[model samples]
Target: MAQKYKYARPGVETTPWNSLDVRVTDPFGNRITFTQRLPE
Candidate 1:
């Protein structure tokens, strides 16, 4: 499955940890990824 979203307004700067990518695994061994990209 695939998903996407957007934010109209964003901060000037964001923390390092704010951007994260988490890998999720299902019982069948399928993997999904979640990521967050901070403001520029």
Candidate 2:
């Protein structure tokens, strides 16, 4: 699920992330971040 977000655009959306979060920046200078809640 998280893998898809790596190439996501401004309008795209997907399931939230887990412990292993991911972030990336495109050539257009757009940044996307995927994060999830930590275990209690």
Best candidate according to TM-score: 1
Q: Write the per-residue lDDT of candidate 2 for residues 1-40, one digit (tens) a residue.
A: 4455544434434434435455668867778776655564
In model 1, which range of ten residues has the least summed lDDT? Answer: 4-13
Q: Candidate 2: which stretches are off by over 4 Å?
A: 1-20
> Across residues 1-40, which tens digit of lDDT does each residue of candidate 1 receive?
8443232222344347676566566556666666778665
- Listed in order, each prediction's TM-score against the native is 0.44, 0.39
Clashing pairs in 1: none
Show how many residue pairs clash in every candidate, following the order shown: 0, 0
lDDT of each: 0.54, 0.56
Error of 2 at 12 (Å): 20
